[model samples]
Target: MIKRKFFMTFIVFFFLFPLQIAAETIEEPDVSSEAAILMDAKSGQVIYGKNEFVRMNPASITKIATAIYAIENGVLSDQVVVSEQATKVEGTTVYLEPGEIVSLEKLIIGMVVNSGNDAAIAIAEHIDGSLTNFEKNFNVYLQDYIGVSSTHFENPHGLYGENHYTTAYDMARITQHAMENEIFRSIFKIQEYEWDGESWDTTIVNHHRLVLGEFPYDAEITGGKNGFVSQSGFTLVTTATKGDLDLIAVTMKTNLKNEPYAETLSLFDYGFNNFKTEVIPKGSKFTVDNEEFVAEDDLIYTVNIHDKVSNKINPSGVLSIYNGENEQIASFNLKSLSAPVTKNITDENEENWQANGFLGTMELAILGVSAIIVVLVIQKLRKRA
Candidate 1:
C-alpha cells in the first residue's frame, strides 16, 4: 500500500513540475504602440516583437539612416553649400540662411542633435547632388548594403510622404548597423551640440527625452532618435546597454508623445530581465570527425536567462545553439583548424552518396586510364624485343 501511494505521488509530482516551471516564464510586455521590436544588438536576434514587420511612418528616426549614410559616403571636413530650398524645408530647422556653408560633419550633428530638417536637406544635397538622387541611391544602399528590405525613404527628413515608411524590425536593424561605426556612435550619443548656423547660433539639444535622462530607467541610455507627424504619430528608435548586453528598441505609431517612450522602457525591461548575451570566446575549439575547428571570432547570442544552453557542431564547422527545449536559437560557422577528413560511409551517408559520387567516379576513371597506358607501354617493348 505504501509503494502504491509512492508511485501515485511520483506521477503527480512529474505532471505538476512542468506546469510550475512554465508558470515562472517572464510575462510578455504590454505596449500601446502600433508596432514595436526589441533586438539584441550583438546577435541581431529579436527578443520581443509586436507587428514588427508592419510598415509605418518612421518620422525623424529616418535621420538615423541619413546620418550613418552621410558619415560613410561623404567627407566630414568638406563644406556643404546649403541651398535655398534646404532653408525653406518644413518642420524643425537649424535656421540656415541661403547659400550658407557648413561642414558636412556639423550638418550631421545639427540634424541628429536638433532634429534639423534643414540640415538633413543640406547633407543630402552635398552627398548626392540633389534630394532626388539621394532618395534613389539611399534606397539601393539600404537594400543591398544595409540588408533591410522593407524600409523605403522618399526623403532625407522623415516628414510624411505616402511612400516614406519603414518597419520596426527594419529600424532596429538600421540602428544596430549604425551603432557599429565609431564616428556614428560618437555623434549619436551626443546630448547637446553648439550650433553656429548663420541664423541659429545656440546649443542644439537632442530631442530624445530618454537619451537626455528625462525619464527614470536603470539601463544606460546610449543614444536615440524620435519623430512625430500627424500621419505617422510618434516614432522612436532607442539603443541602451546593461552589463554585456546591448539592445535596440523601436516603437512606432503611438497616439501620445510619451507612449513611445513608455513602450520603449517596457521593452527594455523585458529584454534585460528575461534574456542575457552569451559569448563563445574566440579560439574555442570544436571537434568533428577527429578534425578540429575553432571560432575565428567571438560567437555571441542571446538566450533566455532561465534556460539551459547546449551547442551542436556539425562536420562542416557550423555551430547551432539550442535551449533546454532543444529549440535552436542561433548558429555560427566556425573556422576549420585542420584539414577536413574523408569520413567513412554508413547508412546515414547513403542518402548523400549521389551528391558525392561524381568525385569518386572521376578518380576511378583516372586510374583506369593509367593502367591502360602502362599495359600499352609493356606490349610495345615486348614487340620491339
Candidate 2:
C-alpha cells in the first residue's frame, strides 16, 4: 500500500511540476488588434508580435517617414511658401494658404502633432519639387534608410490608396529608426506644441490619447501617432520608456475605439514586466583558449527577465548568448586581441599553435637546421673534392 502511494506521488510530481514550469514561461497578452507588434526600441528586436509582416494601408502614419525625411534632408531654418496644391489636400489640415511663409521646423511640428495633411504636402513639395517626385524618392528613402521590406509609399501624407501600404512589422521598424534621430524624436512626442505660423495660428496638440495623458495610461508615453480611415480602421503607433526599457507598439484595424490603446498598454506591460535590456559595456574582454578578445562596441540584448542570460566565446571567436532554456539568443563578432590569453600553456601544448603561437620560434628553428645542414653538406663536398 505504501509502495502504491509512493508511485502515485512520484507520478504527480513528474506531471505537475513540468506543467507549472511551462506556465511560468512568458505569457502573451490577449490583444484585439488585427495586426500588432511590441519592439525593443534600442535593439530593434520584436518582443511581442502578431501578423506583423502583412501589408496594410498606413493612413496618416506615413507622416512619420515624411517628417523624419524632412528633418534629415531639409534645412529647418529655411522658410517654405505653401502651394495651392498643399491647401487643397483632403482630410486634416493646418489650413495652410498659398504664399504663406513658415519655417521648415514649424511645418514639421504642425504635420506630426496636428496630423495636418497640408503641412505634409507643403513639406514634400518644398523638398522634392512635386508629389510624383516626392513619392518616388520617399519610397527609396524608406527602403534604404529605415531598412523596411514590405512598405511602399504612394503619398507624403498617408492618404489611403491601393499602392500606399506597410506592414505592422515594417511600421514598427520605421518608428524605431525614426526614434533614433533627435530632431524627429523631439517633433514626434510633443504634448501640446503651440504654433503661430504665417497663416495658421493655433496650438498643435498631439491627438494620441496616451501622449496627452487624457486617460489613466502610461505617463511615460514620450509620444505617439494615431490614424483612422473608413478603409484602414484604427491604426496606432506609440513609444514608451520605463527605466531602461524603451519600447514601440503598433496596432492596426481594431474594431473598438480604445482597443488599440488597451493593446498598447498590455503589450508594454508584457514587455517591461517580462523582459530586460542588458548592456555589455564597450571594451569588455574575454579569453578563448590562449587568445584574448574584446567587444567592439556596447552590446545591447533584450531577454525575458526570468531567463538566465550568459555569453560564451566560441572557438571561432564569435560571442554567443544563451537564454534561460539554454537557447541561443544572439551572436556577435568579437575583435581578437593580439595579447596572449589568460590560460597558461605547457610543453604539451607547444605544438598546438592555436593555444600559444610559436610561429616565430618555428621559423628560427627551421633557419638554424637549414644552416647546419648546408654547412655539413659543404664540408662533405670539400672532403670529396
In terms of TM-score, the best-performing candidate is 1
Q: What are the Cα lDDT values of the candidates?
A: 0.91, 0.86
Using all chains and alpha carbons, the TM-scores for the candidates as numbered come to 0.84, 0.81
| Residue 241's lDDT in candidate 2 | 95
Q: Distance from true position, residue 92, model 1, in Å? A: 0.9
lDDT of 2 by residue, 1-385 (tens): 9999999999998674663354367689998878999999887777988999988997888888898889888999999999998999999999888889989998898888999999999999999999999988898988987789899998888888999899999999888888989988888879887787666677888888898887675438877899888788889999999989999999998768888888899999899888878888999988888788888999888887765567788877899888656678877888988755465566447557554456777888999999999999999999999
Instruction: Report RMSD (Å) for each prediction in the order shown.
Output: 10.0, 8.1
Q: Indicate the worst ten consecutive residues by lDDT in candidate 1.
A: 16-25
Model 1, 173-196: lDDT tens per residue? 999999999999988889988777
